[model samples]
Target chain A: MALAADPMAPIAARVARVRRELKDVWTIDIEVGSGGFPFAPGQFNMLYSFGVGEAAISISGDPARPNTLVHTVRAVGKVSGALTRLKPGEFVGLRGPFGAGWPIDVAVGSDVVLVAGGLGLAPLRPALYRLLATRENYGRIVLLCGARSPRDILFRIELERWRRRLDIDIEVTVDHAAPDWRGNVGVVTTLIGRAAFDRHHTVAMVCGPEIMMRFAASELVNAGVSDEAIYLSMERNMKCAIGHCGHCQFGGDFICKDGPVLTYRHLRDRLARSEI
Target chain B: MDMVQSDERSILTRAGLDALIGTLAARGYRVVGPKLRDQAIIYDDIAGVGDLPAGWTDEQDGGHYRLEQRDDNALFGYAVGPHSWKKYLHPPRLQLWSAKREETGFSISHEPETIPPFAFIGVRACEIQAIAIQDRVFLEGPHVDPHYQVRRAGAFIVAVNCGKAGGTCFCVSMGTGPCAKSGFDIALTELLPGTSEPIYVAEAGSEKGAEILSSLPGRAAQPAEIEAAEAVVTHTAAAMGRSLETAGIRDLLMSNLNHPRWDDVAERCLACANCTMVCPTCFCTSVEDASDLSGEEASRSRRWDSCFTMDFSFIHGGSVRASTKSRYRQWMTHKLATWIDQFDTSGCVGCGRCITWCPVGIDLTEEARAIRDAPAQEAKP
Candidate 1:
C-alpha cells in the first residue's frame, strides 16, 4: 500500500547564518522556505545534522520572524557539535515545533517573571521577546539571568538594550565571577528574592540545568508564587519528537509532548523523586 | 433441519477447523499460528491445521518454559509462548525513512510499505487486550504511526478461549481474561473432550467473522452446548497461578520509589532485558541512523528498545538509569503506575511472558507484594 508522509522525516532547511554565542555555544538561523516555520515561544525542533545525528534544540529566535528559524546549540554532544560546526548555506534536516510552549497567554494582565540559567536563556528568549513586543499586555516584567561567569552570559547585547528600557527590570548574575566582573556574583535563585513583581498575581517561567531549576522553583515558591503560577522547561533524552520513542518520558508525562514546559504544580511531586 | 439459528452460538466439528483455516488463507491472508519449534511454541507462518501444535501444551513458570504432551489431540491447549502478536504489527525493526544528498541540500523519502494483511489464529484474551493497549500507543495518539496504522487496519484477529491456565498466567487478576472479549473478529471456545470427537463453540464478533462463519462447515449450537463452552473459561479463570493487587497500585509504586525493596530486586536482576523483550505491551523504541561510507546516502530506522538497557535513558554525559535498581523501577512503575496516567490504562495485560522469560525469575508480583508487605519507615513521607 502507498504510505503516507512520515512525520519523522525531516524537511531540508538551509542555514541562513551562524553566530557564535559563547565558547561552546552557537546560534544558527535556518531558512525554512517562504511558508515560514511558525511556532510558539518555548517549543523545540529536532535538528538533524547530515551524516551525524539528531538533537532536540529549543527555538531561540523571535516567533515574529518565522522564516528564519533560530536554534542556540551547545557543542556538548556529537549531533549538537556537528550542527554548531556547520557554515552558512549548509543544509540541515528539521522536524518540529514540538512540545508545549511557555504559558505567555496565561501571563496576560499578570506580572511575568522569567528566570534563566546558563544556556537556559535560549529557550526562554522567545517568551521574553513576545512579552517585550506586546509590552502592554502584561503587568510588570522582570528578567533574572545567571551564567557560570561573565563570559558565559548569552545575548549580552540584547540584554543591555532591554536594560536601557525603563518598563522592564533586568538582573544578571554569575556563579563564580572574576574580580573585573561588576554584576552580582551569586546563583540565580539569590536574585529571585529581590526582583520586583506581585507575588500573588505573578507567572514565573524557568529554564536551566535540573539542579538550578529545582532550586529556582523552590525559591520562587518561597517568594510567595503559587505552584500553578510557575512553569519549568524540562529536558530528557529524546529520539522521536512525536512521543513514539519513550526516551523523553518523565514520570507519567512525555516531556516531548506533555511538556518541555510544565506547571510547577504538576511537577511538584515528580520533580522531588530521583531517577524518574 | 428445524434448528433455531444463533449468530453467537455455532458448533464446529474437527473438519470445520480446517475449513476455517482454508477460508482465511483463500482471502489472501498470511495465516499465522502457534507451532512447536526450538522446544517452545512460537508463532510462525502456518499452511493449515497440520501446522498447529496438536496434542501439545506448554508448561510455564518463572524463568521456565517446557513443551509437554497432552493426552488428547487438542490443537491449542497452550497458555502462551515466547512470541506475541506484536512482532507482526510493530515489528522488531523498521526503516522509517531514507535520505539522499543533493548538490544544494538533501531530500527525504519514505519506503512505501507493502504490509501483507495478517490473519492471526489462536490469539488469547489477554493478548487481545495487549493489542488494544499498543493501539493506544501507536494509533490513538495525536500523531499516528502510519506504518502501524496500515498494518493494523487490514488485520484480522481470531481469539481463542483458554481451557487451561499456565503456571505464570494471571489474566484473571489483570481483568483481561481467560475468555476472549471485545477485540476480535471471531471468538472460539474449544469444548472439553467428550465421547465422540473434538468440537468447538464458535461465535462471530464482527460482520467479516459472521460471513466467514456462515461459509464454514458448522451447525447452530444448542443452548446446553454454549453453556459448556462458558464453563471452560470459568474453570480456567480460577486456576490462575498468580494474582496482583492492582488497587491503589499507581500510588503505591510512585510513593515507594526509594523503598529498600528496589535495592533487593537490583541484587537479583542481571539487567538482561528479557522482561521488556517478552512484554507484549512494552512499546518503547529507539531510532538509529546509518550512513554509507561515501556519505551520499543515509537512512534512519526504529528498533525495539528495553527500559532495562543502560543506554535506554541516555543523555549528553551518561545514561540516566545507570543502576539496575533504577532501570527495574522505571520498567515496573511505567507498566503499573505511570502507564495509567499516560495512556489511561495499564501497560501490562498480565500475559506472564515477562515472569516466564526473566533469566533470574524475578516475579513482579512477588516484588510488589514484598514492597506492600513491608514499606520502608520513610516510604510514605
Candidate 2:
C-alpha cells in the first residue's frame, strides 16, 4: 500500500483573529482552506509555525464552525509562544483534529457531568456548548471546573451565563483564592462530593492532570458510577498522529489512533502499570 | 542430448572473459560485483574482470570476519557483505518532499528521482531473498515508497551460485541460500582451473539474461559443466558450519517475555544501534526539521531511527522503556518474535550481519540459544 501523504504540510491560513480568554491563554481563530475539518470536540491539531516547530493544541471552537477553526493555546513551548505571538495575517500549519473523542451519542439522553481542570476545560467547553444548544436531549447538565487560582478560570463569562440557566449547574473551584474571591475553595473533586447526582444515570467525562483525573474518577466511582460510564481523555507524546509511529502506544493500544478518549473500564488494568 | 561430453561446454578462456568485461563496460551499464575491502568482502563497481577479488575467500563467525587469499583465480568469490541491495534501492536517507513559501501561499513539491539502471554482477541467493523481503516492506505495504519501487524495477540482477559457504552462514536454516536456484536474470557457477573443464555454467533465468548472453561472446554449457555446477552447490550445502533451531522459535520467544536472559544480554549490550544499521530488513525511521539561522523557513527530513534511542518511546514527560534492559528486550523480541505477527515472516534472515557489526560481539543466535536452554523459572508468588 502507498504511504499516506504527509498531513502536516502547512496550509495557507491567515490567523483569522485572536481573542484573549484568560490571563495566560489566547484563542487563535484560523481560516483553513481544507473545508469542514470534521473534528470531534476533544480532538487536537498539531499546530506548526514556519520556523518554530509544532505542538499539539486541542480544537476549541464549535464543531459546526466550518470556515474558522479555533485553538486555545497557552504560552508553554517555542511553538506555542510563536503561535501566541502571531498576528491576524500570519500563517501556521494544521495537521489534524486527530484521535478518538468523547462519545457524544452514547452520552445523549443521560445526565452529564463534565469535570475539567486547568486547560482541560478547553476541550470540554465545546461538548458543553453542544449539549446546552440542544438541552432537551440531556436530562441534567453539570460542569465542575477547577483552576490553579481564581484568575486562572477560563471562559469566566460563559461560566456565569451557564450558571444563570435553570437547566444547568455550574460549580467553579480553585486551588488558591485571591483577596476578593467568593467561590468553592478546594479542588474540583471536593465539589463533586457535595453535588446531588444520580450516579446510575450520569455519564461522567473527566479531563485533567493525571493525578486530578485519578482522584476525580475515584470520587465518581465512589458515588456509584460504573467504570464503563466514566470517560477520560489521555495525553501522550504523540509524534505521528497516526498509528505507524509507535511512540504513543499504551500497552497494546495506540493512544493517537485508537483513542485520546477512552472509558476507564478499557484502560483500568493497563493504566495500573507503573510505567504507563 | 550429450549427457557428459567435455567439449559440449563452450569454454570462455581467461582472455575471452576479460574481453567480455570490456565489452560490457563499453555499454552503459555500471557493473558492480564483490571485492575485498577492510578485511571483509564488499560490493563495488568493477573496471574489468581483474578488479574482481579472484581466488579470495572469507571466514565468517558470530561477530568475526576475516578474508583469506586463495591460490586459484576465481571471479565469484566470498560470502555476503555488510551492505545489501537496499543501500542503492532504499537509501539510508532521501528527500520525500520540499516546500517553498510565496506571497500568496506555500508551494509544496514532491520530486521523486528517476532511478538509473545498473547491473548487479554477483548477487547471492540469500541476498536475493533479502531483496524480496525488502520488496514486501517497501512496495507491498500500504504506502508504496516510490523511490524504492523506481530503483527496484531498474535493477538487473546477476546471481552467483554459492560454491563455498561461510562459517557463520545459516541460510540453510532460513531456507534462503547456498544456491541461486531462482529470482535472478542469469545464474553463474565458476568452474576451477584444475576441474575436468574450465568454463562457467551460465543459465538465463529471464528473457533479459538470454538477450544479454546471446549478445556476449559465450556459448551453451555442456552436460559436464551442468553436473559440475550441481556438485558445487551440494558441496556448499554440506559445508554449512552453523544451524539455527527455527522450530517454534516465534512462540518460544513470545511466551518468555519476562525471561531473565534479556537482562543477562543487556549487561553487555550497548544499545549502540549497530545491529539495526547493518540489518537488511530493519526499517524504523524518524523525522527531523532544519531551518535557516534567521528562522524564517524550515524543511522536515526523515532519517533512519532505531528503537534503541531513548527518545524513540518518549511520552509526555518520560520514556516508556527507560531502562536499557527494556529497550534491548523490545528490539530483540520485536525482531525475532513479534515480527512474525507484523510482517508474516521471521525478521532475522540468519545473515550474521548484525552479529558481525555489533561492537560488543553480542550474538543474537547465542542469546536465542541461551533463552531456549534456560530452565523456566517461576515468578515470585
Model 1, B1-381: lDDT tens per residue? 222144768888767878888889999888999999999999999888889998899888899998889888888888999999999898999999899999879988887676778999999999999999999998888898988888888888989999989999989989999998878888889886654556889988888988888888888898898889989999999999898989988888888888999999999999998898889899889998889999999999999998888888888778878899999999999999999999999998888999999988899989988888976544431
lDDT of 2 at A64: 75
Which residue pairs of candidate 1 clash? none
Model 2 chain B, poorest ten-residue lDDT window?
A: B1-10
Report interface Cα RMSD per prediction: 1.8, 4.8
RMSD of each candidate relative to the true structure? 1.8, 5.8
**Residue A220 of model 2: what lDDT?**
90
Off by over 4 Å in 1: B1-6, B195-197, B376-381
Candidate 1: tens digits of C-alpha lDDT, residues A121-155: 99999999999999999999999999999999999
Candidate 2 accuracy as lDDT = 0.74
